[model samples]
Target: MRIRPVGRHALLLDCDNPGQVEAWRAELWRRRDDGELTAAEIVPAAATVLLDGVPDPATTAARIAGWTPGPTATTAAVRHVEVPVAYDGEDLPAVARHWGVDVPEVVRRLADTTFRVAFCGFAPGFAYLTGLPERWAVPRLPSPRPRVPAGSVALAGPYAGIYPTASPGGWLLVGRTGLTLFDVHADPPATLTPGTRVRLATA
Candidate 1:
């Protein structure tokens, strides 16, 4: 683990392990509940973590690395949500073709693995999931779709994600869902918070 100071008030933690990222994410939730690390926010990315407190990034990084894993990591609060989606995307057939597999096989492989949220990006409540099956992984379209409807489940490279809102996108859409991933009125607006374990339910 390496820590670098972004400025005077934040630290960038680089830990390549997804497991390590998860550990810290869960740990932060614990500290937030128990009052250990006092920060405005803990933003966990695919390969990095950001702490919105403290000035000296080097010192703080050392402390966090030596810190022990907390209890919240083991708690049942971490949720694995099953999101049901329609398997009728325009790109579905293309995905099957790209992977050299049938559409049914594509769905089977996608549902086989439990994905972890690598980062929240592109839009509100959108989570970039890591570790999609290699066979089904493909690149984005040559041209970005003018408006990818919300809840569109897609795969590109080794990642899969759901569109949080209607917007332009290039990720190969495999399906769409009616479930709301974000709601401004709610306390935690994003449905798939970082560290959330997710699985897809085909409609």
Candidate 2:
């Protein structure tokens, strides 16, 4: 793990892997809730967590530097969300070929796996989920679609994602859902915030 100062009041912890980031983020959030750490935001990414709006960067950095990398004892308050999906995407056959399985097997595998939100990027409410085994990793499309419809359940590399809005994307579309992933008028705009667990159910 490497700690780097982002600015006057923020520290970016570069973790070795996504597991480290997830574990550390849980620990940090636990500390903050227990009145141990002070920060305005604990944002997680692919392999890093950004501790933003910190009161004392120097002290926090030093303190974090001494910490060992391992699973934290923190009990995360995880949220589980079920997404109803129609496994009828244009790239469904391609994904099955890549996995060396039939179309139903692909759907069954996705339905069985409980994915977690690793991060949110690309567009508003677009979450990058991780949970699929590394061996089942899929490749991005050779060319991006001119416009990917909203709620398109897609996969790329080891991450599963849902397109929040109509836009150009490169991820392999395996399914689609009617659930609204993002809503500006809602309390929390994005439904799949980082750390939230998601399950894809056949619609």
Candidate 3:
């Protein structure tokens, strides 16, 4: 891991992969909760975690440099959310073809996987979920849609995602849900924060 100053009060930890990033983020949060660290935000991305609004960047950097990440937190320690989906997307057949399986098998496999929120990006409340095995990875569309409706469950590369709002997107759409992923009026606007476990259930 490489730690770099992100300004006067933030440090960006560059991890080797998303798994390491998740592990580090979980450990840092545990430390903060146990009164070992102070930070305003612990934001995670694809393979990095940013410690923002830190009181002492130099000292904190030194402190974390020696720390080694432990195993990922158990499921009981994280939030679990179920999103009911209508598996009737335009790309469902294509995805089935890619996996050399029928559409029903595609749905069954997806529903059986327990996905975790690896990170959130591209748009508000849009979570990049990871859990699908490498063999199930799918490619992005050749061209992006002008507007993929909100709650569209999609896939690209090795990650699955849900569109929080109508926007142009290139991921393969497999289904959609009615869950309100983002709501400005809500206290915690996003439903699927990083580290939250997610399951896509058949609607």
Candidate 4:
């Protein structure tokens, strides 16, 4: 675990990969559970985990290095969530052109795969999922749109995601999902957390 300073209040854990992120997330949480370490918050991300508390860098680093997990270790339990989406977006045709196929083929290829929530960012509960069809490597829009409406499903640069809430974003928009991802009333907020598998299909 490589800890780096982010201004003064936050520290970043450079895990470097999704598997590493899961391992560190599991390890840190285990350590916290065993009282081997303490922190205010531990949020895992794509290839990195974050510790947001003004802890002494040296002491925190030492503690992290010393703690070890038991022989039988496992990544946190992940849930498989099926999210339904409608293939209707402003950028659908562009995505189709990029795929060098008809619009229906774009939808077919996307729906055929099950992706994992690599991390959540950009906006609240907006998951940056990975494992897109390798053939479909996309680039972001030349210029981002002013305001992508809430629930606008977008795809860009090997990532797929829903807008979660109406917010300015850069991921290409490909489809819209009827499912609601973030709600203050919901427990822990985002329905799909990192490490969780997501299966998307037509609504």
Which candidate has the top score in lDDT? Answer: 3
Candidate 3: count of backbone clashes, pairs at least 3 residues apart or interchain: 0
TM-score to true structure, per model: 0.88, 0.93, 0.97, 0.81
Q: Model 4: per-residue lDDT, tens digit, 1-203?
A: 57777766667888756667777776776777877676777788767888777467567876676755343253345578888888888788899899899999889888888888877887789888887866788889778888888888788887888888887777678888878899888997887777678877888
lDDT tens digits, residues 1-203, model 3?
99999989999999998889999999999999999999999999998999999999999999999888788888678899999999999999999999999999999999999999988889999999999989989999999999999999999999999999999999999999999999999878999999999999999
Model 1 lDDT per residue over 85-156, tens place: 788888889999998889988888777768877678778899988767555569889989899988889888
Give the worst 10-residue stretch by lDDT in candidate 1: 69-78
- The residue pairs in collision within model 2 are none
Clash tally, candidates in order: 0, 0, 0, 3
Error of 4 at 79 (Å): 1.5
Ordered by lDDT, highest first, the candidates read: 3, 2, 1, 4
Give per-residue lDDT, candidate 2, residue 83: 100
For candidate 4, what's the RMSD?
3.1
- After superposition, the stretches of candidate 3 with alpha carbons farther than 4 Å from their true spots are none
CA-lDDT, candidates in order: 0.80, 0.91, 0.94, 0.78
- Candidate 1 segments whose C-alpha is farther than 4 A from its true place: 55-59, 68-75
Using TM-score, rank the candidates from best to worst: 3, 2, 1, 4
Provide the global lDDT of candidate 2 against the true structure: 0.91
State model 3's lDDT. 0.94
